[model samples]
Target: MPGKPVNTATKNERKLNFWERLYLPEVLKGLGWSIRKIWKEPSYTFQYPEEQWYPSDNYRGRPVLVQEEGKTRCVSCNLCARACPPMAISMESREIDGPKEREPVWFEIDMLRCIYCGFCEEVCPEEAIVMSKEYDLTFQDREEAIFGLDRLLVPKERLADRLAFLRKQQNPQFGSTWEYPRENNRHSLRDLTTDAESIQTEQ
Candidate 1:
């Protein structure tokens, strides 16, 4: 009642020698290679808490809201929230009298749900949100992990390194299309309507 042989082996398959069949030689060879490399090179592992590693500007760490001129750069367009893979970003937009007519009444990013994928940063039209160099995060409770505007807003000056890096490393396909404009957040449908009315009056 035994099943027939599958015969899956190729004709070119080489038979293993006595040492190869045992597999001990191969394991020892791998160990020797690892030990040789370790002896020849400096230790690659960092002594955590004592030796801190500063990541490059290209590294995507915790996401933060960019603040400029005593105001949040975000116009509450909700593009970041929409692009977030884990739906970590949430905000409530409110009508305001400033040049930027719409602003986030309360912007929040749940660190517990955030994957730090940088999708939010890539889709932010106003460059209002960008990844920062902070890697260490610890929360005692669920509420502590939810980062609100008070914890998220970072001064533009402090984030200059990341901003410059982003500008320099823009996608080739985008060309100059994704260039950050400081006044873009100020632009709204009202401005377009006003411009149209002025043009009509002139005509």
Candidate 2:
């Protein structure tokens, strides 16, 4: 049988005092707090287009490919593309004659779809992709927002701070003391042969 309709409204609610019910005192108090903050606190506002704000190493702004020695560090592993939640990254890979035999023939990132979550940077095993300090992004249209290899690749020298920060974070205890050797990233017979020849010449 249905019991008497319960007084749900009165069950767990606190009764308002005279001042609270009046509401004017609470409103005045809030206004006073705001005014105090405005008068006492320093402004964080910047004059845009005139005074640009430079972000620090830890800032996650935009994902960019690392360009080392005139070529992209990415070996077309596609881990970043797969890890991207928005599916903003797309690429086509082709066989290449190099220490890293596979490279992206065409790589593009749709900035409009990219959420800037840093998933692409995090999943990249080669440390080929990393978050840069370029926060100011403006696009006239959808087509303009898509970034190609030309716009996406940043020289490793220019990204040294970010790379160092990443290394420190990845190896906190070591603090940039540990890094993968260049030789470890290559497995081609050509690279091995070159190394052996160089060793023989030195000896």
Candidate 3:
């Protein structure tokens, strides 16, 4: 004996005829739609190199160290290197005679290893390293891809858009709770003049 049917169809399913089975009409319909789009729709593609595309402020292109007042804003804190997942950033810190007592003697980023994850940018307390808008990077060899301070440093004036975008993207609630004091990035707040005055009084 045959097994009983477990389920039955409520509505009758339509069977395809010879013409419908061939699928010529559906193929023609798709071809016609594509042709219409090709003629009517505006072309989005551009001839690169000759015609360069500008990225939006929100775009995360290459990462660059911010330069301010003809000097790198990086405090040599090494937070960015520690935060980098791919270990693309490396630097050597040296003592400097300035408000920021420490500075990176040589800073480098290996573009080959960098995943463009933006982790370095997020962890930087000084906001020294930020994602730039320059995405067109062509390297001939592996050695050439490693960017040093000369290539990595971008003037803060040129990065105004990215800076403003970052400020806008920051959560207001978080910003209020954790107040960012720029002076804190400096190694010391002790004034040299005040120290000298105190020394004179002691003498």
Task: Find the candidate with the highest TM-score and give its number.
Answer: 3
Query: Per-residue lDDT tens digits of candidate 1, residues 1-203?
Result: 97877887789999899998999998999999999998898988999989999999999999999999988999998989988989999999999997889999999999999999999998787899999999999999999999999999999999999999998887544565565554454345777788778889999
Poorly placed runs, candidate 1 (over 4 Å): 1-40, 171-203
Q: How many backbone clashes does candidate 3 have?
A: 0
For candidate 2, lDDT tens digit of each residue in 1-203? 98878666766799899999999999999999999999899999999989999899999998999999999999997888988999999999999896899999999999999988999888787999999999899999999999999999999999999999987787445444556577865545778999989999999
lDDT of each: 0.91, 0.91, 0.89
lDDT score for candidate 2 against the true structure: 0.91
- Model 2 residue 143 distance off true place after TM-score fit, in angstroms: 0.7
Residue lDDT tens for model 3, 1-203:
99978786557877778877889987898899999999999999989989999999988899999999999999998888988999999999999897999999999999999988999998887889999988888999999999999999999999999999998877566556556664444433355556667789999
Give me candidate 1's TM-score against the actual structure.
0.67
Candidate closer to the true structure by lDDT (higher is better), 2 or 3: 2
TM-scores for all candidates: the values are: 0.67, 0.67, 0.69
Of 1 and 3, the candidate ahead on TM-score is 3
Question: Model 2, 59: alpha-carbon shift in Å?
Answer: 1.1
